[model samples]
Target: MTVAEGVRPEVDARSLSDADVLAIRADFPILADEGLVYLDTGATSQKPRAVLDAERQYLEHENAAVHRGAHRLAAEATERFEDARATVAGFIGADEDEVCWTGNATGALNTIAYAIGNASAGRGGREADRFRLGPGDEIVTTELEHHANLIPWQELAARTGATLRFVPIDDSGALRMAEAARIIGPATRIVAFSHVSNVLGGVLPVDELVALARDAGALTVLDACQSVPHLPFDVRALGVDFAAFSGHKMLGPTGIGALYGRRELLNALPPFLHGGSMITTVTMERAEYLPAPQRFEAGTQPVAQAVGLAAAVRYLEGIGMARVAAHEAQLGARLAKGIAAIDGVRLLGPAPGEPRIGLASFVVEGVHAHDVGQFLDDRGIAVRVGHHCTQPLHRRLGITASTRASAGVYTTRQEIDLLLDGVRDAVGFFGVRA
Candidate 1:
């Protein structure tokens, strides 16, 4: 548990013990509450003490309008804000200028989608022509996408007169890459997909999909909300044109997220919002804007939240991402196997033995998902139910809703067993027929 200076820890990620997890859990105050078994990290994670302390420290001592004044407090606030930006950029292997702050991952995705829409309207002149779309052009995505990744593209396509298509999922709820190859052809202008499915917890083949988009001369957008927290992510290594992720999902504060774009592409795209800070010059009839990160971040920024996110980034780095991925993978396999063994329970996404994160969504025959959630809740086990903001994916899987239980760094095998026990009791209580 002691990390050495200037040396990355070499602990075996898959061999993390229950004591190791429990020790980590001690850093989060909420986890100390009795009778609380939190298993819904896919929605949002519990914040660690470090992140909370950072935010509180910033608010108490460095509270000021960043980049808007020349006072001492303002300078300190601006330095802290930009320092946070640098920390987050390093975490994702991106440049500080390439990272644009937004309200959340949904806002980040919408910024990209709206910027492209602006380009289609001839806003950025020749530099933005690459992003333009019109009749006969297609935007490709996958059916496994969460609604945040889906709706913006749908709106963009509607605005630009482009067709929106998706690669369908197979019977196992996995994306059919063959269909992707057929759909992402010469006519495709852009391709967007999730690095890891929020509902399914299955990691998609990002390299293959990015290659397909590249070969077709289309822009790539990665929804990295799920992957950034659970995997060893490098945005530069992934080579996508743009990516989006949230702070709250990674043990940071809410109301803050980042959109990472390639510098050249970001320079070409028009601003999604207009206000006080983003502008370079302005007149009664004309206005010019600043470059990338600043261009997208209009008005006041989330100063304290950014500082908190940087602390979260440092905390994860202290533990090492390799270990986080390995621990989650081990627990994911355990959850999948245990769920599959239950009668009248249908687990969604990749079958047992498949590579997945620590999450499982399932339906209980003869019992609604809400009822199952309530049953678990009564037993002091927390889980998410319903469509999980993935109505299309659920419809494709032939269900209206499902119950989801997800884990994080602090989760242990004993907690997984409790969840399984809760599921079994719920099934028996409902008197489900064989």
Candidate 2:
């Protein structure tokens, strides 16, 4: 296992009070609200002034269709769009050609899943054979998957006659690797899972899981929506077949996200979305598709959103991912520890101090998660309270729903404390405790 260097040995995600954090928070104008404890970054992060300004500048000055026209506005817009691609590509450790655009992480994931199904049906051009699915093939994921990762596979399995299987979750709400080893054997054609669990807060043991899937000759897909913005992600180093993540969840504008596939693999995979920009030529008889990323990015694309996302990438780079991750780790550990101390509270992930991201999902005994969230909301403490789109994980964890608090660069310890305090009051107010 490759443990990242410079990970502070002691600090939890909330422990960073350094000048660097102060400066980092200052760049995000929304952080000026000292009273509002925003702990919903896992759902969507708050935007920084730089990203907002970049989007505004593009709309006010260089708005035009990209990759289609030869006019002055098109030239400038094309330059900015491609430059934005370069910026995002560098941020995630991928070549520009390996990254494809989508509306959101859900869209990126569904695009890949649907494309694979299309390929299975002999619809994905020359690359169709590589991803062909049938009754003999098994597609594997985990019980911890968010519905975005889970449902698409389910639908694809139904479409292609492939058997859909999943790695089981233990009592602690984690993918049981032992069960995974048994499920992803020779018949397995693809193994997809989250890099970080949205409900569990556990970082999946990727290298070990990847090794098993690779040995079985299966392609590997990763959902990086929960990991990339919160931590440093290197797609090449991670050695996955494909990956997907959203822009808005990381403080970028909504309606844009990215999908990354290895260059060779992408070249061999059929284009998922088809339209004007995705094709080289078309006739009444047949259409020849473009290659790799361009083949995947259909239509005019989300130019301003891409620009905003690039600015968000630059903003994150300026603060440094290592620092951002360190800060989150500290907060996560502290949040886990503090929550554990309260009676009748059950955490829905790895235990305290286990490797985790800056996200946590837990339930207050007898208090419906929605009620807990509403109680917290009364104090201006915004948090996501529900099944968290992982009904399968909740079912495995023996619960129906959970309240989650996911942190980000702008999140603070004092703010987390407010959440903790709110949870205590919520338990009493909801009569979850006697």
Candidate 3:
């Protein structure tokens, strides 16, 4: 199933073979190392050769400041940068003008949060009033959010006189929709949440939540760092006013991410970072700004990283996102079942046989997460340990930390089996009664 250039393969998700999976693994150089079982893709993915080459070629041949100079190199660089934007926009079902580049997803999220805060302080004139928040207003999120998603809203609430609220999660780590209905009401001005839980691997009901927010006359913000890589996502279809995702988590470079916003809203929002490349007319006193994306992207951008991210999108497109989702779902079931069979292991997120992405987090009885991680590492299996940047969720689950194993397109069933084997060994090594 070798993908043709500029052509997406028509692949049946359920029909993918071990040979097909193994063939795709060759495109990632890190997978070639037999001693390493890289299963921490929920944190960040390994870059494929296509993505690496795209970035390297841009840096070596077309390195120049985009949208600034009148030289040939500058023209080429600008063209490539805008082309990358278009690629990312098309990938997420958004217009090119709606996508804004930032340092990372956290940066993108902060850009939106701070811009709204500025609006509350009377920035961007009357058009920005839609984003304004005060004492009577409320912001809604979830307890399952990563720190990046949680902290920004907390600060936003503090800056404004608005109150911050969260939807509680059930014992099974699923969002309590009934509680959400009660929390999100007339006073709610903004609804922010993750499309997928990074620690628990639980998929959220975006459509239902978006509808609730829409009915409440609230703006919706989606944290798509986990979903964008593993799922078939369309921001427009999801009906979120703003969505943020990181390039590094999706097989591209670090220090680059994108925010997808409604063009009208973006144009109305105040600029976050100010300096060069975002001005329309500058004078000694005040500077006029550009439109939507250019308005938000104030400084020099991540040129090579954007190119690599575009290449990564093309790679995923070649594989077909539906197939990618299906592949991960299949692996998720195996992982869930394997973990459930272990005596002392308590799997988080949805119960066994329930739908989830290809990841699992667990706590082993009488053994700390660090011990579990070390045992796995000794057996040449790489897994993520600690709170996974969701300390609040861990606290809710009545644990301080957890061990997580996340799969990527390059992951194999053998690697998952090894993880299970290592966990069983760790339980016995710790002399747990169970």
Candidate 4:
């Protein structure tokens, strides 16, 4: 795990070696194909056999309704389900009661927004008053946000008569902190933003934003969808009131995700959905709900998926997160340098030699992003195109869409070279000149 003599300063001192990466690739069955070069981990990761086996094994042997039946199967299912919650909670450095399972990151974020909206509408009793928002109240976010992070707040603002403000990013897609101080004032009720730019692949200044929110007495919500999988993440360390992340992006199942909140805050917040499993006592006239995490989870839980996600975290823990971050850092540097050297290619987010994760987005002059994506696809190289769920960021960058190449733990340096070569070939194939 020692740092090489000439390694980039942005890269962590401890990184996985070439042999480590090659060995890791064997865990993913999809990577065994000779022609396939996957660089779309930003969208969804390729699951290892362990994750797949965990889910399948659960479905085969322990399939039962969690928190419902009185049989042995139900007991087993509930035990595994809650154990998965504990695993996820430990992974994020949160109390077990603090983590709430949701459909995905989008659902997790919407749960918060909707809960606040419900609180504003006089739900959850007097304890929920703290979450209430009105006309004068402001919810601050950033210009560079995925639709999942941006739209829910927009809906919350619209429903509650609260104003939504955003901190603008500079021309290079960096957050403008000077402007942020002005925007996040006493009237700001919630300060929601991404921990890392999904489009830019650059980490955001979370500590500074949290400080601003703390000074303003505002609740901080983090979109940890991009950061949690790539970086060594801890909700307690980040000092965010709440955070949301998806399992699919972290090498687990698609339908499950988590929302981490402080225990008191979650208890105070109103529930987003009402159903059988989340309640304590129910009469014909009135019904009471459980506290915190259980209050948030309703109906059928994702039992097998939870087991799978737990396995995914365990797999990641086996390979230290610091080493994972360092590996991605090296890949990011290579992407930046190679893309920068290419004629007519504009690298988004951090420039070459700057700090970023193992992902890069760019625009090629005289070529549509879709064309570039298709060109890469033709060469059996997978990448992402379009605004990448960040239309506002794309508009700010003065483009409709761009191409993105991302990596995961199973990705190798050789695959990164393949993508670079494909992009270069695409520029020539599209008749774009220096």
Candidate 5:
């Protein structure tokens, strides 16, 4: 369905009214299930009918291996595939040649790490010298990074004999900017960080980090998994050298994600996965690969998934990202305030009035996170439990896990309220008192 089909055309798309949001919710078939309050959008979003239909249409009518065949179907498939690339590029404010499709955000991050490792091993030759790392060189990231961002760097450091460092976070899960300044110095070869904390929900200062990386002559890699789908993001505006985000978290299918890099950087970096569909020419002894994206995309591409992601991007654009940010801000504030008022509940990330995305992960004293999650699920309120793939962040908080209630565009105030009520009941039921 068109974005304007169910929603009121008279209303400005920049401001999504309650009626407009409800109308938008009608596009998701899963939400039609009665009493189902899905508050775990941070984990993965419910797919819109538009995204589902887009993938289905491609699979049923236009399925063919992209850039490999000479027939009409193959030609049409290749056109659709490249068009999807263009659409994704536009969404992230990147050039068409800068975006590369991957299996997921983890794979995307690994792609950069492995490419750097290859450079250190002298795979890309003199042009890839920019990516080389050595004993004295440091790869700087933050303690708040998801494992997907952190572990890859760790592996890279090990493989290249480089040191891996991190900007520390305080007890409240906020990044220590002063420490970050001190830690990220001339030795840093790369600065990788999350755009938003999946655990804490606070937005990181991207421009500030970019400036630090620039001064250090280091490349900046952004984990935009949490920010791109919800915020009005521009990779060029943020000035990051590379970024990675997933389709599943942004209202599209799983097994599809993207890595965006500056065209020059991507072209200079060596290919991570080597196989068919990415090479320009092959000799019995040696092979030469294509440019940035093609060199990275080896084997069969996820044609249907890419089309679905493009559809998801268009759907978000229809509602306007500014409006999405505003709506989620309101929900974040409500969640923070409500959780703060509940005895024995400790809210993570920003304070009640502080800026954050529309997600709250909190610890309820004397209750295990899994117990809380079960209670919420019993009441038809779904939330994320455990470390949210941020074990280091959780360890810093002195907790093993926390229950996270995250919102989406389709989420209503009532849904947040229901989540809050569920948490309250969970506390009471578990006999947890402050």
Candidate 6:
């Protein structure tokens, strides 16, 4: 059962032998095919061969329904599944029981929102009454939120009779945290926002925001969908009440994500979906649900995807998270500087660029975003183009869409140079001026 689990290897990335990096990249078959420069890690990362193999090995050798049968294969499957959960929990600095699997980050966020609504309808236990609210209560978010993060809270507010308030971003599209005190005050029941803005790449002052919400006795939710895969994240240390993210973004298979919540809060909240496997016992009139995670996971789980995600976490651990963050910082700084030098490119998120990631959304003056994307695509540079599911932020920024070039640890300086030259060419093709 001891398959070299539960540890992040301790080695400075700079001090690592060249062979180490080569071996790491070699484990990813997709990296061997160098036809494309993937600047869309914010959407999803390329999976390593190790992760794919882990999934295949599980499906081939240990396939079974987890935690139900007395058979040996079932036990093996359940152990691996729970081990994957433990791996994910450790990566995020949470207890294994605190993590619940959902279809994706979108599913996790919606599950939380729907659970809150259920609690408001007198479904959750006594401790959940604090989360239940009517008029005068508020759910606070940021203008720079992804739809996965924003829509759920919007629905929660809609159903609970609570008002939805948000911290507006400045002209540069960064969260105006200086005005956080003014925007988030009494009556703010929940303050959920993205740890890193998907469009801006700016890291919000999460610790400060969590502190504010903690003091206000409000629940705090953080969308780590963009941050967890690329940065160091300790959910407990961050003091966020709940954190949600997708596996695909971390180089794992799709249809798998995790939601971390405080045990007490989760035990009190109701399940978003109810059916087989979540209940302890059921009568014709009433039924009792399992605690926390089991209560949340109601149907057949994504066992193979969990294994892939565990493998992805191991991949990240072998590389070291600090190294990933440092690597991304270098690339992000380079891209930001280059984009700034461009005549007509208007950047989204933070302009001055402080503590940011590789996510950079920019508008090519007078050119449509689709055209920019097509130009980049023709050059084998894959980027995300459009409103980026942050339509409100786009509206506030006075743009319909923008071209986003996000980065990952595997992204190289040569690829960035390609994007730089490609963007200039697109600008020329469109005959745009600053």
Q: What are the per-residue Cα lDDT tens digits for candidate 4 across 218-265?
A: 999999998889889999899999999999999899999999999999
Which ranges in model 2 have alpha carbons more than 4 Å from their true place?
A: 1-15
Q: Kindly give the number of clashing pairs for every candidate.
A: 0, 10, 0, 0, 0, 1
Candidate 1 residues lying further than 4 Å off, grouped into runs, are: 1-14
Per-residue C-alpha lDDT of model 1 across residues 126-181, encoded as one tens digit per residue: 99999999999999999989999999999999999999999999989888998899
Better of 4 and 6 by lDDT: 4
* lDDT by residue for model 6 (1-434), tens: 11113225675555223344445556667878778888998888988877888999999999999989999999999999999999999999999899999999999899889999999989877877877888999899988898888888888888889999999888877667778888788888899998998888989889889988887888999999988998889987899999999999998999999999999989999898999889999999989999989999998999999999999899888778887788787778778888878999886666535667877779999899999999999988999999999899899999999899998767776778899899999888899888
Residue 365 of model 3 has an lDDT of 82
- Please give, for residues 1-434, the per-residue lDDT of candidate 2 as tens digits: 01111233233433456555566677677878776778999999988888898999999999999888899999999999999999999988899988988899999889889888888988866657889899989999998899999999999999988999999887887677889888889999999999999888889989988999999999999999989998888988888988999999998999999989888877777777777988888999989888878888888799999999998888777656777888898889878988887888887787887888888888899878888888888798989988889888888778898999999987777778888998877777766653
**TM-score for candidate 5, residues paired by index:** 0.98
TM-score for each model: 0.98, 0.95, 0.98, 0.97, 0.98, 0.95
Provide the global lDDT of candidate 4 against the true structure.
Answer: 0.92
Can you give the lDDT of residue 245 in candidate 4?
97
What is the alpha-carbon lDDT of model 2 when measured against the actual structure?
A: 0.85
Supply the TM-score for candidate 6.
0.95
What is the lDDT of every predicted structure here? 0.92, 0.85, 0.91, 0.92, 0.92, 0.86
Q: Output the lDDT of residue 217, model 2.
A: 98
How much is 120 displaced in model 6, in angstroms? 0.3
Report each candidate's C-alpha RMSD, comma-separated, in the order given. Answer: 1.6, 4.1, 1.3, 3.8, 1.5, 2.5
Which lDDT value does model 5 have at 327? 90
Residue-level lDDT of model 5, residues 53-103, one tens digit each, is 999999999999999999999999999889999998998899899999999
**Which regions of candidate 3 are displaced past 4 Å?**
1-7
